[model samples]
Target: MSQSEQPWWRGAVLYQIYPRSYLDTNGDGIGDLSGITRKLDYIASLGVDGIWISPFFASPMKDFGYDVSDYCAVDPVFGTLEDFDQLLDRAHGYGLKVIIDQVYAHTSDAHAWFEESRQSRDNPRADWYVWQDPKADGTPPNNWQAVFGGAAWTWDARRQQYFMHNFLPEQPQLNVHNPEVQDALLATARFWLDRGVDGFRLDAINFAMHDRAFRDNPPWDPAGRTITRPFDLQRRVYNQSQPEVPEFLERVRRLTDEYGDRYTVAEVASDDPLPTMRAYTKGDERLTAAYSFDFLYASTLTAGRVRRSQGNWIGPLEEGWPSWEFSNHDAPRCVSRWYDGPDRPRFAKLMNALLLCLRGNPILYQGEELGLTQVDVPFEALQDPEAIANWPRTLGRDGARTPMPWEEAGPNAGFSSGKPWLPVGPDHPGLSVGVQEQDLDSVLNFTRKLLTVRRGSPALKWGELSFLDVPESLLAMTRTCEEESLTCLFNLGAEPVEIPEPVNLGGAVLSQSEGLIDREGRIMPPYAFVILRD
Candidate 1:
């Protein structure tokens, strides 16, 4: 398809808004749908093509909004369904697509389906959840471990069986293998589609299916690595990543196809995610795109890492599109994880440029454009259940989930009239949107310019990518459309690096470092990057 005729999501820049932290319009200290609507103009100013709002469904707040109780209802803390409709209409009015999260793998124990299923074995929805009988010795069903900790199977006395849970005990696994359960989930999706949602970001989709036989997962060799949780000690051979997952995905795609131009992207996190990511989005019958934790959890950013990530998606026509995210609500902010140098602002701009230059859709998390750093949330204030359970060992997701700073001076940085549900970062005030708006050289403005360039350039938006020969510290590649081509170069290291002799540095279209480029073979300073029309 030609660039203009392509789907709206192809190579789109999606801005992710974590509803709890984006902005709180009500005095509840938690952000709501109305808050997102209030900020639609600010989000539109960033030049993003769409917004991906994380789960705001009715939940018990055990895993935040992940443990959903009612699939169709909005949590009272957020707003009513009417509020969401207004947010959707306003977002569309700003020419931005709206993509909401769908947690299909499990639901809060308080859900009517789970509540009824656990009441008795002969209940109509008894088979809707994964319930297994105990072993001969009265031990739990299998060796599967929950993602949070301890045994995956939780004992329910009413049913006299151990029910499965992949995360917290409150979130029970749904037996997606059951045709009735699949039909119900599809109905929920259809409900949203009818309500005018442009797409869905399927959360932890690989965990939706499990091994029906309840076999033990083989022990995974740590290879001298210190294991944090028992869950990390197993290969997860049968707990998830079932062969039938693609079949279910085909059904999801078919449902989405009914809504013209609708999109679906799966979030797949595994020890080896490329294979599953490929499988989940391999063809037209599956998801439109899928993203992994490859870049999210990386300790460092390097040329080879970027090359391999990009190279994996370059393949035959049957291969599905990919989505890339450097930071999110779950992962620590990239500025804190990747670079600790004095010149963090420079590094942030370079990273932003690199993300937009990639071939796939680039997902920019809230506060990323402001160069936000991970906060050091204290033990007393930590809210993440996984982190609380494994304290001092893990860097808890609370640091990354802190409230976004909007003003330099405020009670909680103007994120709320009341104290935010999560603490705002100490340094976030200086990097607040109010502070960056006045400074033209700020990372926030630089990101806006870079996004504008990407939106206007066919090569950056819809081009095929090919790596160019360059030094170890530098990443060089070319993005080419039919008649347009642009060369992108990044200096990932602390020291200066020279471009190879064969490459042409051509006139700079967009650049980070001021005095680094020259007509002669150019040298890029620490964390510098440039894009040139070739």
Candidate 2:
């Protein structure tokens, strides 16, 4: 493809792989690098443009892989540096781009830089992290709190001061205000780019910079609260989404541009995410795309709700791009979250098809193709620190991060010969790849067909989205490019709906539920969708 022909991310589908739970090669109960290498063919068959691997760098696993010890090397638990090279080579061979996670906001306490900074306040590296003296009463510098639970600031006895840790105490937040620290992080990105990484999945990009004055955040009054997640109680204003974040983002953008076509997608989450996303991707030399938790947290599939969430793209996003995902390692599975009971399989198929037809790049979480639902983790069986800390009220993300189910009858669902870290979902065996591959009507096949349809039709990929004036229960829209026009009608309600006028297109190009044709017009089944050509 010529440079002009390739916009880098047009109509792309990025598959996310949570490294530790994807596959276990040695059966040490944890998934590793080589295990991911072995599954390259399977990923390629899904028609994804790239693979976004979550953090696999050296870490203490305090916040799972989000807490990095080494910015450049792969963790020994994952495999040697050689294994990453092999994985990269294999992924490229399959025509799949590799985007590794870049956790720039914080580092594991075990990191060399953190160790040096903690040794003494006057050390050369002491300013690398955010450190502050204690108040007269020996309390933390501010009312800031950690994202995991309480108090974002942690006191270091040696320095006789408190250091900012937005997450856990072991993961100290970096002082992006320091030019040296910014340069060091840029070097890390350059290292991966030099190693042939196509892009980066920036973890908590907005949190990289914080207000220096340590101001108190306003209180948030949530309609309800999760017992396990205290962070939800307070509105996180001062501690995150700092004003200086986009300034550093422009620098990261400049660094990525050195290697042509290298993309960066920021994982942005805040009460005001649309504004932050707009700021991050506003200019020409900034992030390629930004994703927030708008869709992931929503439990309703209503037309008005979906339209309000997705259709409301603010700022320069219309010129820029967006990355959307229904589920990831952090959130509960979409299928299980929205639809329960026997009809879940059908709903899951419909949801996949619906997502594929949307405007921006789509991301498929591992095992989403197989129609995997969230597994119920018991109190004793849970291994996620976040879940363990906030148990009863919050459904810890670990349930969605279980080992991939490859084979129905094989041991450990053929994920590994060794014991897996987390138990596979109970229905995983029936929903395994082996079983789904044989069943033509399976969710996996439905997803593949939907992707193929979208890939074949340029209208659905790069077209403009305009909402059609339809009933509240029906989501009606049209996607059109210069050459082609397609109309998509979805019945989000449980009861059947009938459109009074004839569809603009000749017939539906794809649908999960049955498409009904009547003298009045196209009769849509309950929760059915149709794609018509005008």
Candidate 3:
């Protein structure tokens, strides 16, 4: 099928499952592959098209499962290789495509590839990782800073040189500049593809390649932006966001294209990622789609931010497609971040409404259907590297990654029979799946209705988005496809505002929350959103 023919992933709602927190079946206090298999039916009932599982590969778990030690096998903590195979089969049986995480950016320090590369400068895999000589003063090769708050280079005694690591020190950066490294990474992708994965979610894809010259990064002025860590003090142009990334993506694309309909969505991290996103997905030969931290880490969700973030890329013809995600394992939940206090329930519903109605493909994180909020993980129990390293400064990801609450009354809310890796919050039990299942008007059911509405409407699934010039506080946009047009308006603030156009939760509406508009035809209360079809 052509790009315009609407492939399976085009505008698809992909549900992101963080396996370590999804469920625990083996009584190990950790979520495993079998637990995910058990919940396949519940996930399918959410009306999402596919499930994008986070890293479950064999890893040291330094950064959780992202630090891959073996690309082909599943980690013991998650489950065995057989468990993953069964999980894949069960997901496909539920009509859900399985997209596994492919970490091309780096490998664990314990990985065999890294072990050999670190042993000697002339080993078979010696040049597989980025290595450089230290300065005369015994300092790092350059001034490039790591994402987790330290110098980007770490000393390796065996190789007698420093190796680059964009994140944690345990996660050494791969030398993708080497053809051998690229080939090996591609082979890993092929391995998973051969194992029945529909596609791959390239983790930290922009970090796949870097300037090989060991160039120093320029400093950035903190006048207009908030600098959370020392890593944020530099422009990071030379350390990452290399021009060679797109070419590497094409190689990956050409490889996946051989598999017929295998999609790739790059996770871009940059100061200005919209342009990078456009460049990365400029053609079909590149990534199938790309998403950045536009709305994910934004302090406030405004109409202008939404418009610029969504409109930066031209139509799908000029630029490749874009994927939008409000909350993921990396960032805090939307209800806690975007939904202003007062009407929490209404706000959660409104947030989901806007997310599903966006122009790009929507990525809904697990437990978002139950209106899950961020849990306040104490500093003592912190797990993320960046979070632990920059505590009090960083709002660690542990809050968003806590175990998925299944029952309101069961032990640890039915997430595990034993104590979970992360403690369950007091507020999560009331928002558990079991609790939401009994309430017909719960956000869980409302999300199901919204998704059902989305699937049936061509205007929503494949439509061009144009922002309507209303108040800045109100996000008004129209999705048009031929004769069918759907107008979405949301009051993302506390003050009530007059409706730009007369709309109701009646006929013209596909789905909406009731009793929000005042008698004078004004959208009232915080977080009021409505959809009108014409």
Better of 1 and 3 by lDDT: 1
* Whole-model Cα lDDT of every candidate shown, in order: 0.90, 0.83, 0.86
lDDT of 3: 0.86
Candidate 1 ranges with C-alpha deviation above 4 Å: 224-226, 519-521
For 1-534, candidate 3 gives per-residue lDDT tens digits of: 233677888888999999999999988889999999999999999899999999999998999999999998899999899998999999999999999899999999999999889989899998899999999999999998988888998998887899999999999999998999999999989988888899989999888888878788889888977777888899888877889988899999999999899778989988888778888888678888889999988988887888888787537545878888889999999888876576677778888889999877899999889888898899888888878888877855999999999999979999999879998878999999999999999999999999999987777776888887777788877887874788788888777766665443333767777564563556555577778786
Question: Any idea what lDDT model 1 has?
Answer: 0.90
**RMSD to native, candidate 2:** 2.0
Candidate 2 residue pairs in clash (backbone atoms < 3 Å): 27-418, 145-151, 145-152, 146-151, 146-152, 228-390, 505-533
The candidate scoring highest on TM-score is: 1
Q: How would you encode candidate 2's per-residue C-alpha lDDT over 244-328 as one tens digit per residue?
A: 8888999999898888888789999787888788778775778988889987877666889778766855223345677889899
Ranking by lDDT: 1, 3, 2
